[model samples]
Target: MIKHAALVSFLMHLDYFDAGNMDSFVDDLTVIPAGRGTDAAGQIVVCEMEYTGVYGIADYPHVQYPVQRLLAQISAWLLDHDTDRTTPFDFSVNVETNPRDDSKADLEIRIPFREAVTASADAGGELALAGEHYDVNA
Candidate 1:
């Protein structure tokens, strides 16, 4: 599972928008397990994970362009981080105005990742869970 703080830090590092505006732009970040699959040995070997969040952006007259650019940057980052360029990632985004604060709008995003988990033996011959590999299309 990806740590929430790590993901937030990554977003702040992106150049699509000023990092100073992050606190106002992002409301929440969550990582959840969507599904799982087993390998031939009946061991859980694959997982479907999701990163869901709401971005509360200030309602500038031209908010859409910056939001769109930010999404593009996120997509590129996901692709670059993908370990396996095979399966496709599922990404969804929705934009809407905040109910209580008309001056702020919400950019809801759901990013899905398919991860492969395997068991490997280290030099000590102890079996250990290897690192996860994201399955994403090239």
Candidate 2:
């Protein structure tokens, strides 16, 4: 979650936004190759997001998200509003799959969308989760 904003900003600066017939930064976007780096808490929500539009894949780019200092704000907003945000999100191309334990998520998303996706599930069953919910308490 913390790296989300930074990643987004970087992508944007690199021209990662869709604008009519303009060139898209990424060919496609989905949730098959990312969504890792989440907390061990129950309740994990995986939202399929993306940033399109870019001139071309640059040779190199510099970016920052200030995860340490800004993560709290993002987390606070989620917690304050009771939103599920256990996974560290970022705009990506193709599809990616994120695991619940965060031990290892197959970072092999080169396609659009994916199967066997993990979702946000709450501990103590207080929050009912869908799909393959990863139990942080476990």
Candidate 3:
């Protein structure tokens, strides 16, 4: 099992356009055409993982729980939407800010799809991601 601290460390060191990680999660996103990177809206897709409310070594225990849950949620979301079971998006992150809260951060994962049609999931034309449970924006 990946510890919260270690996971946090790994996440922090990750780059949005890291080729290795992008290739690994490609299947979780969309299928890429042979030479199609000329979409009107660009070919980059982003997935954001948010972590809010408090931060510290002591919070590691509590922090990890949500992280694991979020990971699972993302997996399910991808499985449900990805028909081709592949995506070529690059991942990124977005860290929010809170005056009252101790910590506020968001992780964004992105992919570059040949077309929006390929990036879409089977959700009746709208990507309503489980009522913002995971906030999956494709």
Which candidate should be chosen as best, given lDDT against the real structure? 1
lDDT of 1 by residue, 21-135 (tens): 4542223334343334444332433334343444443432234345567667766666677554363444444555443244334444444443444322234433333443333
Q: Give one digit per residue, the lDDT tens place, for model 3 in 1-138.
A: 112233334443433222232111222333333322224342323232222211122222223344455445444543454333354133222222223234322433332222222223343434344332122223
CA lDDT, every model vs. true structure = 0.45, 0.33, 0.31
For residues 14-68, what per-residue lDDT tens digits would candidate 2 score against the true structure? 3422222122234444444444445545434343343232222222111232223
Pick by TM-score: which candidate is best?
A: 1
lDDT of 1: 0.45
Q: Flag regions of model 3 displaced more than 4 Å.
A: 1-65, 86-104, 112-138
TM-score on alpha carbons, each prediction: 0.44, 0.21, 0.25
Judge candidate 3 against the unseen true structure and give its global Cα lDDT, from 0 to 1: 0.31
Error of 2 at 98 (Å): 37
Q: After superposition, how far is residue 108 of candidate 1 from its true place, in Å?
A: 2.2
Total colliding residue pairs, candidate 1 = 0
Candidate 1 C-alpha error for residue 51, in Å: 7.0
Give each model's clash number.
0, 16, 23
Regions of candidate 2 where Cα sits further than 4 Å from its true position: 1-24, 33-38, 45-128, 131-138
